[model samples]
Target: MAHNEKLALLIVLPSLLAGCTSAQMNMLTGKRNKTYNDVNAPWVGSTEEQLISKWGPPKKSYTLESGAKIISYEDMWGPISAYHVCVEKFMIEKGIVTKWGISNCPTRIKGSLPKDTPIPQPTL
Candidate 1:
């Protein structure tokens, strides 16, 4: 390859590699970095009321055509933040928690709960 081409590759290669490394790290430690305050272990059967009582209020929620409900919560870390900032989702069906997951980070979703939605006081 030409000298200029080699030089360009040298500069770009590190950035490309860094991006890949960051993605891999997120996949590996994503769940461990989540912050769950309300519901306890073995979350499969926990009810929506139980979750609200523990984690205050969710940032957003939705109801699907199949009647399943999804509630999301965010962990805000003040001003400075990192990839560790995350949003967690709880799947509820028939008044019972069925599944849950954590995303790499949080993002605003259109039509989400209004900013004024009341966050329930923590019961603990």
Candidate 2:
């Protein structure tokens, strides 16, 4: 109604709309990632079949010389113009999960590696 109020809305509305568009774009492009803190604890000692049933297939996976399997899933957030990503990794040995880690996610799940530790890079 007031001139000042109208001016404020003109400035703020575009920024709000821009943020929504960014999020939507990320989702459509498959750039969005989701974390599962609740499932971390019970995952340890679970078989590969169990992990797949709960979290679905991983986006990428690796196998080490020791026969350990590393499975990873990533999640992304923020506006598509400047998005950030986080990855969760599950280590399975002898068909059972032994440990897991997360990278760049805000909340730390139990059994995650230290924050300073680099995220594991897949060799192949």
Q: Where does candidate 1 have its weakest 10-residue lDDT segment?
A: 31-40
Tens-place lDDT per residue, model 1, 1-124, is: 9999999999998787676643354454442222242232246688888888888788999999999998888775436644355677888899888887766543322222223433222221
Per-model CA lDDT versus the true structure: 0.62, 0.70
Work out the TM-score per prediction. 0.48, 0.54
Q: After superposition, which runs of candidate 2 have C-alpha atoms over 4 Å from their true positions?
A: 1-38, 108-124
Best by lDDT: 2
Per-residue accuracy of model 2 over 38-58 as CA lDDT, tens digit each: 445457779999989977999
TM-score of 1: 0.48
